[model samples]
Target chain A: MNKGLIIAIVLIVAVVLFMTQSDKKEVSEPAMTKAPPPVQVEPSPAEPAAPEVSLQEAFEMNRAMYGKGHSFAWNGEQHTTDHPEEIEASKEATQANAEALLASAMAKNAEVAKLGFEWKLTGDILKKAQQSIDQGNFQQALNLAAQAKYHARIGIEQYHYAQANWHLSVPE
Target chain B: MKIIKTLALNLAVASASQAALAADSGFDMQTVDPEADRIALQNYFKARFPETEIADYVNGIYAVDAGSREQWEELEEFPPYEFDVEKGEELFNTPFANGKGYADCFENGGIGIRHKYPYWNKDEGTVKTLEQEINECRTDNDEEPLAWGKGAIAQISAYMAWTSRDKVFDIQIPADDERAKAAYLDGKKFFYAKRGQLNLSCANCHVQGTNIRIRADLPSPQLGHVTHFPVFRSKWGALGTLHRRYSGCHKDSRSKPLKPQTETFRNLEYFQSYMSNGLVANGPGARK
Candidate 1:
């Protein structure tokens, strides 16, 4: 209650109030200020990504894996690839070559089926190939038979791949 | 340099421990451990849906989704499979041409023997399914065998499944028979192997993709998949055997479906049934 003490207290209170206000202003200053404008980045011009391999190219690559004289072996039976060369030599699709191709396809499909990895479309394709043969469309038949054979080969490959890698998918 | 050496030592130790842990937990393709696989699979679903009871897995998709469960419960009140069960019962009771009925062929008069199916026949050296056995019974009795996939075979299976309502799956892979173990392993391989143009395995949908919607359908967990057999699916609009469903799944995968009761399928059933060993049979089920 002394005059000097009261004056001193008032001055101290004012100082504290001033400091509190200053602290609040400092805390809120960042929020009140505008954020920096977003950076405008121009994407660098670059060459377009290379296109993926075409289906025909992929098919040719797959076919190349089985060399000219390759013999497909399954269940103790070996199916030689002389039919492709024979067809190529004939220059035109022949019933004999078509039948041979179908036989090879059937052999491969049987192997795949035994493994329980036969593709659903393979049988239908084989059937279509047979129908094409019946209709004397030997070229179409040859193509269909080759497609079926391709599917069967893929199925066999899938089976082996699965055998090797199935454990990788098993939940730990 | 000392810090780097210490860090390297820590890394090596950490990696060694990790490898040890992986070896302990990892499933061996060569090894046939049905119980271990079952436990791991069930645990997966349990961890995935902590709220769900293990026994409730028999409900299939209903166990995961509440919305579907409510609809299913409502459907169960007036079950669609009732007529098929009745038909199955009649067929099961009818005597063969030789005066021996299906009852004469089975243990316990075929009342509640659905859970013990896809057993390895040691003498025959093959996996024998209920459906296969039923046909065998017919042939033994001088009766013509029923067709494979649907119709009478499915009906009879449904009746047998109905009789086995609460019986838990108890498929056995005989420890003495290496062939039985091989069959199981083969089935396991088939289940895990990615097939067809889709390149998807059974585990991809049922195990990893459970409760995850694909288009309009929700793939159920694999834990209790075999519990419901000869199910009356809304898609089918009639009861169909488990093999029939297997064929459908194969078709969906764009893989050629093997004929019903093929050796491969029998093995698959053997593996699947073994996985559901602890889960109760709740077949002759109606599903959407």
Candidate 2:
């Protein structure tokens, strides 16, 4: 029994000693292993990267708004938005559309002063619409634009009415 | 037994040492190109909105003309042009129902802390932005996270940017570390990811020429986007956090909006800031 007890104690002590020494050795080893150098990422170039737009969406939206090989037509005159040469042609068409309608209204009213009042009101509404558009208030601008369109329509209607009904002074 | 015990000890020590080294070698800012960035930015804004008085409105809109470090410092006292800075400041200190404020969750209430974004957790292989950082803090403290575009996150972001006004940005994405690289890659994927009914990606309008049709404008590319964030938008009539911008972009693209500070957005912010490294910080800017 004494021999057995002694052997058991010796074994336990040996195990403990081995553990302590091993721990020390392990602790010291990491100090020697240098960490691997950092991976170097190649810096991306400075200029902007390639475009990321969905080609389909761009193509479709463009096609819908300005059709493929489309032409802009006003008052039996044809023009193209894509062509700078046709810009003047389009602008003149729009102006003529506005002017012809205005002339018809003025002819019906016969009173030059009344026509002047309507024009002034139309200008005032357009100015407000432009101001709102510049301010990024899109909803407000939309409302103002609608109002201007309505007034312009009324101006044309009144011009036609005066031309048909108003008495022209027969010149001596 | 001794050999096995020795092996375990060696592994533990190795990991601990590795951790220490990783933390020590933080980010390096020397690689950032300043002049190229400036030229790109100048070309971007000039080509897009040339009719506007960009130079005059640089303080609010254009990031370039917002002045040097010294100028930003001086403009600090004045409320940023469109943001409700004073209101944001008041809200920053206000405690939530859980009896905690923003200071408890962040270092220095997140002031002048615009960089080091889009961080990833290698263990999870995921990314996080500043907004996500804030929300995580809130969750840890048992407080409800604020909704995007409204409430604390937006206000706090505005206030943080305002306080950080005029410092140059220096975001770092660790290339050497496996984890850091994953975060950056994830961020890149997000920037390019396309979604929504509009079927648009964040890169679509911001990266593509969609800005071309609306006006002479094209959205600024990802490069140099990090510097001016948490801006005061004229459309909102209030200061907006970076997270708000993310949500707005998502909404604009017709995608379901992500919560403010969500992990996905945080990673995106990290990637974005990384691109704009070395640009002067002009947070709390007024934008159209």
Which number leads on DockQ? 1
Tell me the docking grade of candidate 2: incorrect
Across B1-288, the per-residue lDDT of candidate 2 in tens digits comes to 665465335434533432332221112233223233334434544554565443322243233332232455455566454345666677777877788877777666666665545455556666666666667777787877766665566666666667776666665555555656545544555564444434344544453322323233334444456556666655787667777778777766544466666566766676666656556666566555
Cα lDDT of model 1 by residue, B1-288, tens digit: 665465446434533432333333334545557788778767767777999999998999999999999999999999999999999999999998888899999999999999888799999999999999999999998888999888999999999999998997888888888898888888887887888866767876776667766656888888888888889999999888889999999998889988889888888888888888878989888899
Q: What is the interface RMSD of candidate 1, in Å?
A: 4.6
Q: What's chain A's TM-score in each predicted model? A: 0.50, 0.30
TM-score of 2: 0.44
Worst 10 residues of 2 chain B by lDDT: B23-32
Residues A1-172 of candidate 2: C-alpha lDDT, one tens digit per residue = 5999999999999999999999987788776474667796664768533334444444445557996456544433454433221221233323343343334333432342243213334445556655665665545544444444545444445445534322111000
TM-score of each: 0.73, 0.44
